[model samples]
Target: MYSRIGLTGDVMLGRLVDQYHQQRPVVAVWGDLLDQLRALDGLFINLECCLSNRGEPWQRTQRAFHFRADPDWAVPALERAGVDCCALANNHILDFEEEALRDTLDHLDARNIAYAGAGRTRAEAFEPALVTVNELDVAFVSFTDNTPEYAATETSPGTAYVEIDIGDEETRAAVQETLNRAREHDPDLVIASLHWGPNMVEEPPDTFQKFGRWLIDEGVDIIHGHSAHIFQGIEVYRGRPILYDTGDFVDDYAVDERLRNDRSFLFEVVVSPTGDLSELRLQPTEIHDRSVHEADDEAAKWSRGRMRDLSTPFGTSFERDGEQLVVDFNS
Candidate 1:
C-alpha cells in the first residue's frame, strides 16, 4: 500500500517549447520520462508559464519575458504526464497579465488538476491545494520571493509572495502564518513549494538554508524549492527531505556551459501506507531540443557526481540504485 509521488521544478511550456509542440506530439515534452511520471500516484510541478492563448505581455516594469502556452496542447501534455497539481507562484505565472493567469487557472480547473499560489484574489492565492495520494491527503502551499510586484492583494489577481529571512521576526511570523493556513487542511503531509532566489545559482545562500530549516521546524513535511535554473543539493532535516532547488524540468532557456542547467533529477518520494516518508529516488534527466528525457550515460554520471558533491556539505549522502540515486530514510 505504499505510494509514490513525483516532484519537479519549473516546467515551462511557452515560447520556443510551445512552437516545438506544434510539430511534435503532446507527450514529446516529457520524452522517456513520461512512463515513469505516469506511474507515480501523484505528481506536483512548479508550472513556470501561463496556459492561455490571449493577453499581452506585462509592461508594468522592465520585465523581459512573457511566457504563455496554448492550453489546447499544454493541458493535454500535462495530463499525459499525470500532473496532479501545480505550484503557480513563480514570476512567469502572470507574465502575460491577468487574463492569461485566469485562463491558466480555468484550464487546470476544467481538467481537475489542482493548483496553489496565483489566483483571482489574495485569499485564493494564499490558499493551499489539496490532493489525495492513495489514502494520504497531501497539501501544497506555494510562494515566491522574487516578484513582489506580482504579489496578490485583497481583491486583485496575483501570486502568493513572501520574503524569506528567518532572522527577521516579521518574516518568521509570515512563514508561520502560511503554515498555519495550510495546516487547516489537516493533510497527512504538507509541502511548501517555494519559487525563490535568483536564477542559475548552484548553492543556496545561508539565509535560504536557515529559512528552509525553520519551515521544517514550524511543520512543513517537505520543502520543495526551485527558481534557480540549476539544481542545488538535497538536505534531510530531521526526517523530512528538503529539495533546495530542482532546476528546470522543461524549458527553452539558454544553457549555462559551466552549471549545466540542462541537467537535473526527476524526484520521487516513497511514502509508507502510514504516510511516513520512506525514501527518495532521483532519476537523472537532461533537456534537449525543448524536450526532457532520462539522462544518457555521460550526463547521468555528471548529474550523480554533481549532486553528490553539492549534497555532501549538507551531511547528506546518496547511494546509487541502478539508474536512480536513492536516499534511504529508514537507514
Candidate 2:
C-alpha cells in the first residue's frame, strides 16, 4: 500500500488575504492547486498566522509584521482545500498574542482540523499530531528555532521551540527526549515539521543540517523544514527525505525580484506501508496576486535547476515526471 502526502511551506492568510482577496472564494485563490492537494491522501502546511479576530499585536517597538486571518474565512478555505493538519510552530502564530492563539486553537478544533506544536501549556505544545493514512500511523512534531520569547511554558500559551544552538547540550537533550517520547507511540512514520533557518538564504546552515541528521538518527522519518521564504534544497539521508526549506506556498508579501522568492514547490511524499519512502515528487509552483498557480516553463526550469544545485551536495537528483519533478535516489 502507498500513501501520498502533500506538504507546503508557510501559508500566511491574514493581512493580504483579508485586505484584498477576502471577497474571492478560497477555492478561487487556491485555483487548480486545491484539486491537486485534495487528490492526495493527506495534506499538511505551516499555518503562519493566527486565525482570530481578537487580541492585540505583540508589544515590541521593533516588530515588523503581525498576521491574523478571520476564522470565518480561513477555516472554510482550509477545509475546502482538504487540509488534514497544520503545523503551528512558526513565528507569526503568536503575532496576536495568547488570546488569539487560544482563539486559533478553538477555531481549528471547531472545524475538526488537527493541529500540532502550539497549545495552552508546555505539555500540549510538545505533543505530536498523529493521523493514519492507508493504515499507516504517521506522527507530526513541529518546533521553531526563531523567537524563543513566544515559546510556551507551564502556565503560558505559545508555540513549541527548539533551541538552535547546536552546542547547547541541555536544549539538544530536551529535543531528543521529546522525539523519544513520540517514538514510544510506535507510529509507522514520524515527520518533524521545523520552522527554522534565515529568510532568503540560498543554502541551509551547517547547524541545521546537523540537527536534522540527529533527528533522523533518533527516530524522525522525514524532516519538513520551512521559515525561509524561498526554496532551499533536499537531502536524502539513509532513506528518509529531508526538505530543507519549502518556500512560501501562498502569501501577499511583495516579491523581491532579485531573490526570486516567488518560486516554490508543493512537495508530495509517497511512503510504503512499511514506512519506507517509495517516491518523492515536487510540483513546481508560484505565488502571484495573492494566489497559487502552476509555474510556467521558464519558472519551472529555474525551480528545478535551483533544487538540483542544492540537492547535488546530498547526492540527490531530479527527473521530470510529467508536470512534477521526481527525486532520483538511484536505488
**Which lDDT tens digits does candidate 2 get at residues 1-331?**
7899889998888897766667887676686688898888888999999999999999853568999998877889999898888999989988988999999999988977888889999788888888877788888888898788889999999988878766789768767777777777799988899999778888888988988888888889889999989988899998888899999998888788866888899999998878778889999999887888889889988888888888999888777897688975436
Q: RMSD for each model, in Å, please?
A: 1.0, 1.4
- lDDT agreement with native, every candidate: 0.92, 0.86
lDDT of 1 at 110: 95
What is the TM-score of candidate 2? 0.96
Q: Candidate 1, residues 1-331: lDDT per residue as tens digits? A: 9999999989999999999897789999998889999999999999999999999999998898889898999999999899999999999999999999999999999999999988999889988899999999998989889889998889889998888777777657656776787788888998999999999888999988998888888888888999999999999999899999999899999999899999999999999988799999999999997999999999999999999999999999998899899999988
Per-candidate count of clashing residue pairs (backbone under 3 Å): 0, 0
- Model 1, residue pairs in steric clash: none
